[model samples]
Target: MGIKRLRYWLSSLTGQVIMVALFALVLIQLVGIQIYRMEREATLGLVNSRFTLQRLVSVTRLLNQSPPALHDEILRASRSETLHLRLETSQPLPDERSARFEHIVRSKLDYPEPLAIHISAEHNPRRVHRPPWMHPHHRPPHHRHPPRPDIRLQGGIELADGRWLNFTSLSDREVPGWSAKAVLSFILLAALLTGLMIWLLQRTTRPLKELAQQAERLGRGDKAEPIAETGPREIRDTLTAFNRMQNRLDRFVSDRTRMLAAISHDLRTPITTLQLRCEFLPDGEDKQKIQQGLKRMEQMLNATLQFAREDGLSEPIRNLDLPSLLQSLCDDLQDNGHDVTLCEPAAVIYRGRPSALRRALQNLLDNGVKYGGKVQVRLATTPEQVQIQIRDFGPGIPEAQQEEVFKPFTRLDSARNLEDGSIGLGLAIARTLIHQHGGTLLLGNHPQGGLLVRITLPH
Candidate 1:
């Protein structure tokens, strides 16, 4: 689970950018440290070489002037961990001379001519302590770093007394390197940079996130206030365009609704006048048929206008107890002699238009009760959504007509009857209301024997 979350985080743009920057910073620090060590070693070597030359020259001059009895005291005083001074009988010199060492010695020494000298180097491997974790016999070859070899400069310089002065000068590889501060500082720096990067990215992207949420609400046909034009110029321009489009759409719907209302109001006078005229007609079968047709026309017109006016979008949303609402709905139906039962559900607080949700639930329940005899409502909740299930007991809708029945003015031959004063708009209006609330309504045939209506709302 941790690895999955890490992968998900790394896949984002902000995460990738931060990772790259951190990687570059670490790489540069490492390279700088390495270069620093190399330069330090070179500087130490130069200082040590000059000190070695001065000591050799000083010891040679003092021994050349001092008596044989005092020479031993001088050599003993000069003896130390890094140098060894001794006087020996004539010894065979090397055929080849170290030209660099010879030149350096000559430049520093003012000794007379025929200054014969031979320089050689010897290497001795350093001993390293074994860590407690590593076994003696089972030691791994690549487990630890290899020890450095110690370099000792072996040289013989002839003096005026016809004897050779031997010296061994050991180079100190431990040049005491100094680097960055405590380990805590590095850790703190990395953490500080990571947090700052995340904050900047979130701040820069916050406006875009709001834009997406508002656009989603708009797509669901819910009314939203105009959003602030924030972020970069391109993003601000996009937000401005979205606000304009929403305003224009709202105006268009308002105008169309007003026009429909005016036409409906004008038609009411003529319909009433015709009804009064038919009142004086003879009591004939044709006259009764005409009157019934006009009445049906008036009913259809009224239903259409009611649908237009009571679309439920104009109602403001608020928090309400959904379980209480369901219990009340079921209690009312039961009081009216309908066989509807609601299981006692846990309290669910939700935010939405109360009137719209109530109307939608009523339509689904009515349709279920009208076709099927008994109705049962159940509620379930999950982390992501809330679901309401309505089941009935009579024959359910055919599989093919399930989706077809949701269309406005669509009625099936079997259960959708005009005798119930259903203008084939209940399910359509219910679905529209659900969608506006960012919810879904679906119809399916229950395995037992009736239609099942399922409503799911995002939480």
Candidate 2:
């Protein structure tokens, strides 16, 4: 579960930017720390060498000036926790190259060639003492302590009488490193920069989010409102194109609807005149046949006019209680002696054109009762959408002809009887209305031997 959540977080744009920024900051900090350590070590080494050289020179001068009997006392008095001085008898110095401190002492000596200086490890026969900076876990056991601190400088300086003055000095202090406050400050800076970067990225991507939402609304057949042309140039250009396309689509639909309405209105006058003429030509077989043809023509024209007028785009949209609407429809059908049932779980409200939706649903229920004997309506709701299922226990449509039934003026021979005054435009009109409300109407065969119509509407 933890890994799944991590993957989800990483998939977002904000997460990706934050991760990259943090990684870059960490890498930079690591490099900076390594460089700082190297420079600090070099600077401390130089300063320590200089200090050791000055201390050695001062102590040597003091010992040479003091009497032979008081030299030991002076050395003992000079010994401290951070510095150690000792007087040794004349001895042969080991052959070894002088370290950093030895060079400083050599330059200070008056007779450089005659003076013998050898650097050796600081060894203590007593208990080992660890530095305060060394962690407990990192410290070696009593047997295997690692080398730390500076080496001991052991050498002899010749006096005027040829008596050799031997001395040893132990360095006890180390250079200071970075403090805790410095590390904390670095981390705080990195966090602040990362937060600033996230804010800027969110601001840049805000327009893209709005664009995506607008496109989705257009796809769902809802009216697309114009968005403000703000942000970068690329975002503004894209939004401008989308607005232009939306305007063109709206104009095209309006023009086509108006043209169809005009044509239907112009044909209605001739249709009425022909119907009146048929009334005057009476009482023969040929006359009756002509009258029947005229009547069918008139019905077709009227159905077309009605279809063109119910173009839901022109209807006013508002919020209405859907369950109540379905229950009321069922009640009306039941009063008319039709077997209709409504299964509603609760009151559900939806935003759409109520009158247009009512006409569409009424057509579906009427079809169920006309062809099939009984109709069952069920309403289901979810967080995102609502579903309505209308089922009928009639001879279902053939698999090949189910889709064809939705085309205007098309009917299945095995399903709906053409003699029942169904111009075959019912399904098409219902589907058109549902689509205008950003919904879908689908027809399928139920598993229990009937036709099922499912309507889905997004909230």
Q: Each model's TM-score? A: 0.74, 0.73
Q: Which candidate number would show the highest TM-score if scored against the true structure?
A: 1
- 1-459 in candidate 1: lDDT tens per residue? 999889978998788989997898788767877887778756756676567767888888888899989998898777654566778986556545567776677666676668677765443424324322222343335736533324446688888888888876655565344436635666688889889988988876777888889987776567888999987788789889989999998888788878878878988889889999999999999889879877877877786676666567788878988999999999889999999998767568887889999999998888877878799999888867889999999788899899999887788868554454567888888998898788999999898788999999887
Clashes of 2: 0
Estimate, for each residue in 49-153, the C-alpha lDDT of model 2 and write its tens digit.
466567767767777777888876776665543344555455556455456545666677664576566553333312236433343344344637543444444
- The lDDT, on a scale of 0 to 1, for candidate 1 is 0.78
lDDT of 2 at 153: 47
Find the candidate with the highest lDDT and give its number. 1
- Model 2 lowest lDDT segment of ten: 119-128
